[model samples]
Target chain A: MAGMRLQIIGCHSATPRLLARPSAQVLEIGNSPVLIDCGEGTQMELRRLRLKFTRIEHIFISHLHGDHFFGLPGLISTFRLLGRERPLHIYGPKGIKEAITLLLKLGESWINYPLHFHELEQGTSDTLLEAKGFTVKTFPLKHRVPTQGFLFRELPGLRKLKPEVAESHGISRAYYLKIKQGADAIAADGRTIPNAVLTEPPAATGSYAYCSDTAFDPELPGHIRGVHTLYHEATFLHTEAALAAKTGHSTALEAGKIARAAEVNRLILGHFSSRYNSLDSFRKEAQQEFLNTELAADGKVFDWAEL
Target chain B: MAGMRLQIIGCHSATPRLLARPSAQVLEIGNSPVLIDCGEGTQMELRRLRLKFTRIEHIFISHLHGDHFFGLPGLISTFRLLGRERPLHIYGPKGIKEAITLLLKLGESWINYPLHFHELEQGTSDTLLEAKGFTVKTFPLKHRVPTQGFLFRELPGLRKLKPEVAESHGISRAYYLKIKQGADAIAADGRTIPNAVLTEPPAATGSYAYCSDTAFDPELPGHIRGVHTLYHEATFLHTEAALAAKTGHSTALEAGKIARAAEVNRLILGHFSSRYNSLDSFRKEAQQEFLNTELAADGKVFDWAEL
Candidate 1:
């Protein structure tokens, strides 16, 4: 199976400044690009990065904040203007459809392509979306509004068939399916061909979990435990912990603590507050608790296979 | 009185691309900056231009399209984040207030400063706003929605007093007010002094009219007749006249016709369709109809007094 790759589009929180656009990211798995949290200038950023918008098939919106989803309508309209014919699937919380529909009505323009909206509800875990060598699941998160997180796990591959054993036993093409399924075959002379003799070990599977714009909740450890890469929000520093709690956000130290508790191999922290001009403090602060921490910057690409 | 200077911030039509932002402009009249139609990525454009946000006091929105007003919430929040204490007045059609309020509610944030909304109703004209040395009036425009165009006319200045005549007639400071009001002043010597003798002729007042995102409507000529500068929308060329009418927009030829009928000193055309890569065609098309035609490009500054 091909490994998943993550690309950071924008990571700043609240208001956009000269250095950043807003909170948006893209996940590339196989031939498809999955967008996450499209902020106000995501399309421009995509153009700047020279990414193909037509390849983006799925969009996962974390929450309903303007910084997270304000750019969606413009992007959708741009796709129509660009003559996109492919269907776009948007998985987000309720009210997203209404907001987009209202904006389109106000513009007096309708999209030419098909747009599908899947409204996610709370208390659902491991709801499979697609099962093409990987499965995408939505889990609940703690936030001021209704929110959900996503977990993507690669499915185990089938065992390879040993050609020498199969040929020697005169295995027919019809019996190859059973060999690949790890079933022992009985030959015509009553000699048994063991499943281990005919099959090799399957490839290793990897998993990545995305916990976006959520407060520090230890209960997520079980859901996101042992993930290869974990993307979490670090809106503020420890000094602004009170403000973070008040806003239903997380501090850098809190995000580090969650990564440490969840036993995630690699921690990618983003959604930084616009107040802090430099991200050096975020690295220093998060590294105090979690060693393998990486700050999310616009256009930064992360490979899951490397992790 | 100081003349009004218009600054073009964003000037793209239908959909914003990577290089272009959108259709936003700033009218700098004296010390204050009146923002017109803040499209998407406007705050970033303002930052790039290094214009002081504190100077922007009033905002005039042409319509409720996403390309016109999507940047309002971000700019408003940025102002609040920068610790602005002054109030902001936004004047637009009826649905603007609801759109802004709903966006604020969804973000779960409130502005620290006071925000006033002046909803424009249909058929309403001559609504006096700020009266420093000019007057602003909104006249009806023919568009798909309830749209209006704006006219900024410089108020006639006070008559210049001839110091020699005032000294000879023994005019008091209190009588200067009457002289400035074009009234005959009665000196302490019981002699009537003619207003013309005490004052020279005042400078001619200048005016600028903004007709954006409108169809080919000749009725606007009477409302904005003889304006010094007119910024009109030219979304298409003569070849796409049918598309312009169907989309509730105007062609370059139509814009020039409006300018010629209104007898404006100079015509500035913008809001171009994305299909035309080069703007020379629009300039040529408009100039063919009206001699004094200028293309409205991003960051182009036009002075009212110069025209």
Candidate 2:
């Protein structure tokens, strides 16, 4: 429960194939569901998975591609119709606000809740959010348009409290929080009690990186190095490497190479081109360079440290 | 084959709930499938029904409401991805081209096929298209936004040819088309055969009209009078007639009056508010004034004269 879980709602590239959705996923980190890239049919898919739409508070978009951004307007409008009161924050490339608000103006369906848009225009990585127990950072991606790869890392949690130890030291209940924060406690006799002797160590945190619609960039590995799981776009196979580069996409082998370079614990490849009949080849090919590689599909879920 | 078939892809109003889709339909007339009002899940519905998306050449949009037009950009982008070569024609309210093209430009997913937009700005009724065996016309509607109601009427076909009559008359094979066009046939001896003697009467054609998100306007029935099937929005019941009028939506009772005044063969009530638990009340209320009324639901199909 303390780890991260990435649920792939859709992972296809270019367009939405029969049942293969475009780019959209629910990354649950720190017990919060963050939406990434809302393509067409995302709302239906969210409903299909029975995930509460209201739980998605923050949305991270990778780029301005239609497959990634086409569903934003509909989802935003649906939120208003559902009488959403909580503020919705959208982080993506510039011009998202204008494009989405224009349709709202035309329909006269302005939202009742606060709608915040954080437009990213820089070509460098920046920390975007610091939430309860995790932080979200964006790194630059090489694409035809402005793109950002999101990295979610959990923060170190507080140390567990030892009630017996605290009682033996005659420590008051008010000082328990300070002891869990690694601070020494002052006992009833005004003597200092070492926190190391009282409480256990905090649980290790996990990290997951999501990079899509990007070409093979050697520098990308540096931003997501040593992540527990890295989701990289493998839009084409090794046979179409040239076309993949020309279109600012990566082949399965190239994505594997990036995973190997980053030394990530596991690799999950997605955003596959619909031209391929079966996705088995993607995993087989990526595993050549990164042994712990898995193919992403609709409704596929990956918990932390699971290949 | 000679009659029209109206397949309701989605008929609920406002947001797309559980399995209820928003406003979208496929009206097949004269053997060609014409798309009407593409909502959020229209493409998925089309795929679910195994309807060939390419067969949809002409798309009619009643208004700029999100439920009616939000899916256009995704559908257009998909057409390009699917390698659609033929041109796509879209008829809707003004500013549709600008709204849709803006997204296309942002995504850089310009369609390879020629996409022509017919934006209607005026509030006057006018014929928009005259195709193979049917003609499409738009009529003004009372709504918060600039909305248009579409009427599709079948054109007269060639008279049926009687092979036995033509053989006995000794008419030339090359003159069969002429005889079918109601021309008299001439025998080898210069004797003329009356057209009625050589050909049978042509089969009758059925017409369908689509109207949604409109208030109760007495003048609307005159525009689509005597249609075989009139699909009107019945967003609320008579109990909420005041609320319906305020929202620029028609109640079931009001829609029934319009159908009765228009003297349509059948009435299909759609666009019901999601607040209602059962749609039976809408059909029952509409049937009070127009006994031939029926309720429209997701995936509901109405054949000509089925009511």
Candidate 3:
């Protein structure tokens, strides 16, 4: 993929403030932009980042909490107001459609474009969508309400091409596609050229997993094992472990434990509680268990090249 | 009233922008703060102004448009998150209750405090609420959908007290209350003192009318006649008069004409269209028809003493 970028539009949890926003992020795989967990001020945050939001076609909501999906109605209305004609797809819990359409109906302003809803009710892992080079899967999350975590895994591509080697072996440009797909080429001498000689090995495909609004569930590591990057919610500190369990949230130390168990390459701790004035402690606590850990903030971007 | 002030949280119409927001304002009548509208980013705007929004008990929505009331659910959710226990009274169209409660239901975040909705379905002018010093009334507004204009009129108070004059007339301190209510005082020497000489004239009570998201209606002037300040929507210029009519909006010239016809002390033009780059033209155009005209901008304030 040429351009694989992850931008955090908002990262704070519970309520939005002047500087801290709720959960919202944009994951751009190649040229496709997938919105995840839109919060109340997500649109404003996107505008602040100067994002071309019209290109967004798929929206994956984590849950139906106000801080997670309250911006859906306003964003949908803005898309219609801006004369967007592309089909917009929304994936969330079963009642999301009703919650959105009710407000639109009361306003007497129906969406002009095609709006698709993929309501996920299953309490197990399920494959949601498959694009050209990536696949999206939903795994169950532990929260007060039914929630799901999304996993984006890049599909393996064809082996790397060695054009000069193929040309020197009497292969023409017309057989490049077949040669890359592991086909043998025949020369004028009637000698068979192995496909391995014409192409090099394929690069490793990367995967990203996003887990938010969940407690310290030991079962989470199985669903996102060996992912390249894992963005897990760390809403509180280890000192507030009881409160985090009561609110169905995870502590920074617990998120590190999950990252260690999953064996992910990199761990990004986000969705910090608004109570904390400084975010340095979150990183310090998570690094205790997972050395390769980072913090996610508004407008923070992580390119695939960095991974 | 000691601390009567009006703060414009967001004044632009249609879609919200980085600097320009949709319709939402705060009208502080004495110590009681009343929110005029709740746009997409009103809460953030309030935070920008450093307002203690928890003191607000009443919210008046002009219409059911997304720009008018989309922030209501988030605001209510923020109140609950902040542990607000005061009752929030919302006055709007009949379907507002369903529009708000549905989102809350889907989020599974029921408001902990008492929320009361005063649904308005009347087609004519009627009084909506009567506070200690002011009364809120609604008048019919011609729009694409059911819309109403709000008028806040300060009630007439007791006559001004002249303490020195009353004491010189041999009137006891206990008889001051009756004298201020236009009662004649009977002195201990059996002498009758006229109430007019004991009290000075009461200051003229002020009124403010908010007419937004409505087409040019000639009857609007009659509903808000002789108000001190009139805030009217000027979504378009006279050059786009046809478009303003089609969209059920008013032009700046048309708003000026209404202000002139109503004989209000001052006119405030707001809810401007995003197409206009320079707001100076709006002020110039309105001043041609109405002498005292001002433009409303985000974070602008209008104090009672200035009026």
Candidate 4:
């Protein structure tokens, strides 16, 4: 697997304000891109970021809230207008299909590409979606509605074989395959070759977990423990902790605590309330507990290599 | 009544483009400000325009399209958060109630302000809504769904009473009201006074008709005939006439033809397609038929006095 990067398209919550589009982000892994939570102006944000829409093969919608998925119909329609032929797969909660279908029925039948909808039911966690060089899973999150968080883990790479040593030992094709699979081999001439002598250790695999628009849940630590990157919602501050709980949201301190308990390498906090005039307060509050905390500003790009 | 002004808040069609918001417009008629076609980013657009949200007493939605009314829920939610106590009246097609109710149910428990819905059905054209100092009437429009246009007419002012002339004719205060009502007065002394001796003619009344998103309909001309300001959608150009018809949209030439047939003093064309890179062709196409055509740009304010 290649390096992965996350781009924050929009981080504002509730209503849009100055310089923010809405709640949307893009995860770029290798050549494929995965869009998460497209809000009203997601397409515009994608345009601003200069991202190729054709590269996005999958979209993950957290819930049916307007801020979460209002831009889906427009993005779909634009894709059709742009003459896209590739199949676009969307994984979301059950009500999303009905919401999208209702929008399509309202005289906007211009989509020419194939759109696949995978409706996720409530309380279903660790649902495997795709497995190639990497694996993707979903876990239920505590929210006002049936929302789910996504986990992405890159598959471990094959061990590298020492070509010079293998050639000197005259290793056969079957013996080379066994060596690459971390097995010791005994030759026909009674010469033994250890697996450590023929193969080097595999590269480390990295993982990213996205827990958006959810209340602070300590249980998430066990599910997303030791992830490379964690993107959590910090919609409010500690001063508004009561309001955050009442609205099924999380404060910056709560998000920091969750990141600390999960032991994630880096924490990118976003989904800020429109009431906040600036993001400085959120950064200050979250960094108090977690020094690796970073505010998820719109258009900010976070590279996994940096973590 | 004061002068009427048309404020273009969000003008991009299909999807928001080039940092412009979606399709929303503010029609400021004297002291009453009415919102037309509240799109997803309308609240932000309203804030950007520096208009007080409380001044918007009425909202007229053209259809059930997301680009037309998806911003209602967010705007309504913000209104509640702002502690607005004034009644907000919304006029739209039959499905508007269901859409708004579903959004409210998904978010807050209840709204603090009084919300009123006037669901419009077919064959209800030319129905008067308010007739205090001005008259607001609805007219049918041709579209993919059930949609209606609105016409606002400022009532004729009372005739100016010349005090010197009234005293010379011995016109009392009781007779002045009858004279202003365009009737000849008969005093208690059995003396008849001509209405011409008491008052002069009233000022010319003005009318503004908003013909939202619709295809070319000749019937609309008769309904909104001779209006001072007319807003009609120009979704496409003449080159895309076939596509416009297939999508139930109109070209700039078609919109201009309607304005020409209606004999409106000024025509404002908007709701541009995202495919077009420039609006020069729209202006040229509409100006070929209607000389007084104006392209409705975002944040542009068209004062009625300019006409």
Candidate topping DockQ: 3
Q: What tens-digit string does per-residue lDDT give for candidate 1 at B190-231?
A: 988889888987777777888888989878899998888999
lDDT of 3 by residue, A97-129 (tens): 988888888788899999999999946699999
Residue pair clashes in candidate 2: none
Q: Scored by CA lDDT, what does every candidate get?
A: 0.83, 0.89, 0.88, 0.80
Model 4 alpha-carbon drift over 4 Å, by segment? A108-110, A161-195, B19-21, B122-124, B161-196
DockQ-wise, the better of 2 and 3 is: 3
Worst 10 residues of 1 chain A by lDDT: A123-132
Q: Candidate 1 lDDT, tens digit per residue, A200-226?
A: 977666677888788888898888888
| lDDT of each residue in A1-307, candidate 4, tens digit only | 3378788988888666657667898987644789998987688778867998767878998887767877787787667767889998999987666666665666445467888999887767865665566778898888988888999877776788888888777777767776887888775566898889888987666788988889989898888999998999999999999999998899999999999999998999999887788888897898887889988989999887753
Ranking by DockQ: 3, 2, 1, 4
For residues B126-234, what per-residue lDDT tens digits would candidate 2 score against the true structure? 9999998899999999998999999999877899999987887777899999988999989877899899988888877888888898999999989998888899999
Clashing pairs in 3: none
DockQ per candidate: 0.55, 0.69, 0.75, 0.34
Better of 2 and 4 by DockQ: 2
Residue B8, model 1, lDDT: 93
Cα displacement (angstroms), candidate 3, residue A150, comes to 0.4
Which residue pairs does candidate 4 place in steric collision? none
Candidate 1 deviant stretches above 4 angstroms: A122-128, A157-203, B122-130, B168-170, B173-178, B181-183, B186-190
Quote each prediction's TM-score: 0.91, 0.95, 0.97, 0.88
For each candidate in turn, the interface RMSD (Å) is 1.5, 1.3, 1.1, 2.7
